[model samples]
Target: MPLTVNEIARLLKVRGVSQYGREPVSQLEHALQCAHLAEQAGASTALTVAALLHDLGHLLAAERDNRADDDLSCDDLHQYIALPFLRGLLPDAVLEPIRLHVDAKRYLCHAEAGYWDNLSPASKRSLELQGGVFTAFEADQFLQLSFSNDALKLRRWDDLAKVPGLRTPPLAWYTDQLAQVALPDNQAVYQRLRMLLC
Candidate 1:
């Protein structure tokens, strides 16, 4: 079953206290900062929600194993892990960007001059794990996705969100935005069941 917003929130609250990979901030703090950046940029509600939940896969992974060891070689593939959990709950506008944000990083590394130099050490390590910089063909392909621009925007915010003590709106502040972009519970459940039966 797909998790409800409350369920996801509870999971985040429990698991997001771990360090965000090697970053100084916790996962929840990074998320809040990213969402704050997106909101400050005047993103749509869907994009804002996407920013808030983009790293949810990391939390889910930590739930399944100890994530405090500071190992960067595990290739958690976090970009893809949260999609099944969130598939029906959020619209494509939100989910697609979350799905592609990792690729967005790769895309930016190749497409933007000096972008790679600005990445944190942890992000640079993950970049190698995430296939390093994209080839020109790969960059072209990523840009073809419908939500590519949004993903890039989210990626930029992700890069800037690691400031350790940065103040941002609380997670509770985004609940309304989450609710606005989420699929109705019944509709989401029905969609999941239909997919299962198919």
Candidate 2:
């Protein structure tokens, strides 16, 4: 299931931007911002990559029309769809952090005391879908998962990436970055299923 360079290129080419929201940023914009912020915070390349692609589920979710708020908000469609597609395409060390990024957000909201109030409506809604507030046991479960620290860092960066007028890096940058990342062949099939956010 590992992604091929061609597959990654196509996926990146599909435009992860969205038309939803008053601010209206593309998915790729959000991801790149998160990656940049994570790098500024000294996150590992793997963690930065996780931040970059964590919302990949949205592409699949949009295609199925399973997106909350008409592709604006919370849902686990990406987790259900994108994760499986990425299984062999990305290393477990890489993919596991992406899988658990949302959980890291949830955990932070509940454990950090004041973090919950800062969550976006989409995040809150998705939290409900993800089973409301995560229990201590759930937090522990995520903590034990691979790349927990990186995921946490990326999750924080993901949230911070949303400032208005923050000039977004072009998709071409990500496309170039993907060239440096190894991917498997046969990734093109997955591209057909993603929602074109651009």
Candidate 3:
């Protein structure tokens, strides 16, 4: 079933407390920071929401000991994991970027000089697991996608969002934005139809 905006928020509230895979900040903190950055940069509502929920796949995947010391071997493929759950709930503007953000990272490393040096240790490690840097052909192919530029912007924000003590608005602050971008509530429509028929 597609998750409601509120249901997504609730899941973030609960599961987002986990440490972001070897990052200093919690998952919620990273998300809020990314959204804050996107908003500060005058991103559209869908882009901002995409920034906020980009890592949601990590949360929806099975609970993990994501602590800095837990050397887990699995690569989770988190970028694609949440799409099935979120497909109908959000617009392509939002969902497409979330799906491509990981690849954006890979693309940037190869396209931009010295980009690889800036990645956090965990990000660098994951880069290898995510198939290393994109080759020239791969980068060109990635650029052809509709939302690839937005995905690149989101990837930049994702990289910068890991500051340990950064302050940003709470998750509740984005509730209205989430609602604005969410799909119409089918259950509510169904109930209204039932009442009309009755």
Candidate 4:
């Protein structure tokens, strides 16, 4: 089932208390910081929400053990995991960016001179699991995506959001914004009915 705004908030408030992979901050802290950065930059509401939830897949990962998922032989692919879960609840504007934010990181490392150096140790390790830096052709292909630019911006915020003890808006603040963007309860049923009619 698609998560409600309250459910989303509860997940962040509860599961998010765990450390973010090996990062210095907790998952909730990183989420709030990224959303705060996006809002301060005057990004669109969808983008702000995307920033807030980009790493939700990590929290949603069932096998997550604070450090377990990070050490897996393969990439956790957290960017894509939550999409099916969030698909109908959020508009594509919000969902697409969340789906692409990790690629945005790979893109930056490939395209920018010193981006690799700036990554935290855990981030660097995860990068290898995330398919490492993109190849030249891959970078070009990634740029062709619709929300790739937004994903890039979100990636920058994600990188900077790891500061410990950094204060940002409360979870309620984003949940309020989320309520505005989330599909109304009836909208899903109406869409299903429409699909059945066709």
Candidate 5:
């Protein structure tokens, strides 16, 4: 079921306070930091919203299943979990990056020197659970996916987002960004709007 923007905000406010996979920051903090970085980088509103909501699946997982991050033994597949909730609510430009960010981390471990070494301990652990570094062919395959490069950029922001005590814009700001890119995917809306010009 798709979540309302208010529902998403409430989810973050309520469940997002828990620790983010043993990272120094809470899940909400991590999200805010990633979105802040994207905004500072002059990313598109869609991309910034993607950054803000990338880890939304994590909140949903715990909320629905009552699983603590500490209780998980293996990959939680959090990247894919947010899709059903966000599919029609957000555009593919935003959704695709959220879906592919974990693979982006794997691709980075393969394509970038020192990338794996820089991963935080929690990130490193999750990477192992997420299937580790991509092979040469796997990296190429991942590159072929739409928005893979954007996912890489998002992954970098995700990695840096665990910083403690970082201040970021409130969730409301990103919710407005979400609204900006939440335009209908159908051409009808565009066609109808075009007729308004005199």
Candidate 6:
């Protein structure tokens, strides 16, 4: 059976319920913030949905002794883990932005385009692992690739969505919203899921 809106909402609630905070926003809250930001900024429905679910790979990672907040430096684990989750559930348009958000940082550094000056300390460290300061040829190769703009936009929302006091919407919101956009085919399931969450 296709995952029902309620079922998906429950799953997200369970999967994303963070164990800490003032209001203690779930991962769902974070996703919603990103979606709202993108929509407010005039992004396509597709891009907004992609921004909402980009960090979903973290849900599928091997349960470690600690949560993401504990270290925020799991580069190798994230790259490998994101591939399978993205391959199975995400469409190409969504997957590309999710895949490239981090890469965009590295590419920006190589291009020396002044964008890197504002990245947080964490992002700068990740760029070092991705190959600090790309050579001229590498810069060309990175720029030649498409999706930079979308990835940058998504990254911005992804950064801005981390509000400390926001509360996650009631689960019903996800069910109701997703029901409006879900297609029958399984390939559209993630899109449906995203539609609801956004």
lDDT of 3 by residue, 52-123 (tens): 999988887755444332234666788998898788778899999999999999999999998999898899
- Please provide, for model 1 over 57-151, each residue's C-alpha lDDT reduced to its tens digit, 9 standing for 90 to 100: 88887776765525687778888888999887789999899999999999999999999998888889889988999999999999898999999
Best by lDDT: 4
TM-score-wise, the better of 2 and 3 is 3
| lDDT for 89 (candidate 6) | 36
Best-first order by TM-score:
1, 5, 3, 4, 2, 6
Writing each residue's lDDT as its tens digit, candidate 5 over 1-198 gives 366676788988888899988889998999999999999999999999999999999998888788886544777789999998887678899999999999999999999999999998878888888998999999999999999989999999998898889889998888888877775553335445556753
Off by over 4 Å in 5: 184-198
Better of 3 and 4 by lDDT: 4
- TM-scores for the candidates: 0.91, 0.78, 0.90, 0.89, 0.91, 0.67
lDDT for model 2: 0.65
Which residue segments of model 4 deviate by more than 4 Å?
63-73, 185-198
Pairs that collide in candidate 6 are: 178-196
* Per-residue lDDT value at 14 in model 3: 88
Candidate 2, residues 79-155, lDDT tens digits: the string is 44667756755666567777777778878976898788988776676677776677899888878876787778777
Ten consecutive residues with minimal summed lDDT in candidate 1?
Answer: 62-71
State which candidate has the highest TM-score. Answer: 1
Give a tens-digit lDDT track for model 6, residues 1-198. Answer: 233445445545666675211223556777777777877798865577566666655554523434543244545444345555435433566567777776666666666566778765656666676567667787677666677678878877866676766654554543454444443366466656778988
